[model samples]
Target: MTTDGVEAVFLETHNWGKAAKFFQALGFDLEFSTDHNSGQLRNGDGPYVFIAEIPEDREPGVQIVLKVTDADAFRPDPAVEVVTPFEDTHFGTREMTVRDPDGRLWSLQAPAKK
Candidate 1:
């Protein structure tokens, strides 16, 4: 599968409201929101920002979501350990999660099948 580039970056935050506001102040437009736990802000072309609340036990950092042409066909490099294999998500996309050598989380996703 070929990668299209980053689709979004999920930023774990203690306060989604403040985070969204901060990004908006910096010129991002609020595209969508959820009262449950997350919201999205976008610059319109690329680099959509998603902020979600997390428990204290979880680390607050960025999780990159890369867009792929076919997530099911993409395989992790043998040298790089994978945390999860491709699975269908409730949001309707197929996705997988992996950790790089530096331990940063990377999520690979494909557009939902129509």
Candidate 2:
């Protein structure tokens, strides 16, 4: 399936509060902040930048989120690899994470089914 566009950029930081402040200072308007210390910010645009605390098992890195019209019907080229199957996210979205041949990670997200 074709992607709609770049949906967001997720950055893993050790300190969410400090990260949020830094981004806000750069003019990223706060969309919403969660109790979990994560939030979505944007500059009156479609794409957003999300800052989240890095999980214990992983190193801090940037993940690109691709917007898809239908996560359930996302069919990639047969030759393309599938790293993680699409699944529901705690934040109310359907997402799938995949790795490119060069080992870059990509996440695809769509609104969850009503």
Candidate 3:
């Protein structure tokens, strides 16, 4: 299936506060913050950025979230590796994970069906 393009960037950081402040300094406005030390930020009309705090021992990384209008209708190409099927996310969306040829993980996100 085809994606509508990146919807957001998911970032893992060791320090949530510092990460948030850094993005704010880049002119991105905080859209909302979760009690669990994660938040969404936006700049202009581009894709929003979602940053979450990970344990200090964990390596921080970034993943691009591709937008799918309908998850149920998504069909990966034969060469694509589907790591996880679409599942409801706590933040209110349906998400699926896939592994690229290089072993990098990418997320596909679709609006929660009403």
Candidate 4:
């Protein structure tokens, strides 16, 4: 299947408030927050920003969540690195991860099965 578009931006931040403020300054409105820490923000036309508290074992970074027509159908060249095979995630979506030439990780997601 073909990729639809960008779905969201998964961000790891040390301070949620600071990150939210930074994105807000860039014009993303607060979408929703679980407690005062994690939340989704949007710039009206969608392609949301999902800000999460960085875990001890995880480094602070940003991951692009791409909307794909089918997560299982996304395949790159054989030389590309696959961080994860497509699988059902806890957040209710089928997702997979692949690393680019520069070592940037990208996640391709499809709607969860019923």
Per residue, candidate 3 scores C-alpha lDDT tens digits across 19-98 of 99999999999999999999999999999999999998999999899999999899988898999999999879999999
**Clash total of candidate 4:** 0
Candidate number of the best lDDT: 3
The candidate that wins on TM-score is 3
Q: Report the C-alpha displacement of residue 48, candidate 4, in angstroms.
A: 0.7
lDDT, candidate 1, 1-114, per-residue tens = 456899889899987888888999999999889977789899879978888988878879887898888765676668767788778899788887878789887888887666
- Regions more than 4 Å wrong, model 3: none
Score every model by TM-score. Answer: 0.81, 0.85, 0.91, 0.78
Candidate 2 residue-wise lDDT, 13-58, digit = tens:
8889989999889889999998888998997776899999876688
Pairing residues by index, what is the TM-score of model 4? 0.78
Each model's number of backbone clashes? 0, 0, 0, 0
- Judged by lDDT relative to the true structure, which candidate is superior, 2 or 3? 3
Candidate 2: lDDT of 79?
61
Tell me how far the alpha carbon of residue 90 in candidate 1 is from the true structure, in angstroms, after superposition: 1.7
- In order, candidate lDDTs are 0.82, 0.87, 0.94, 0.85
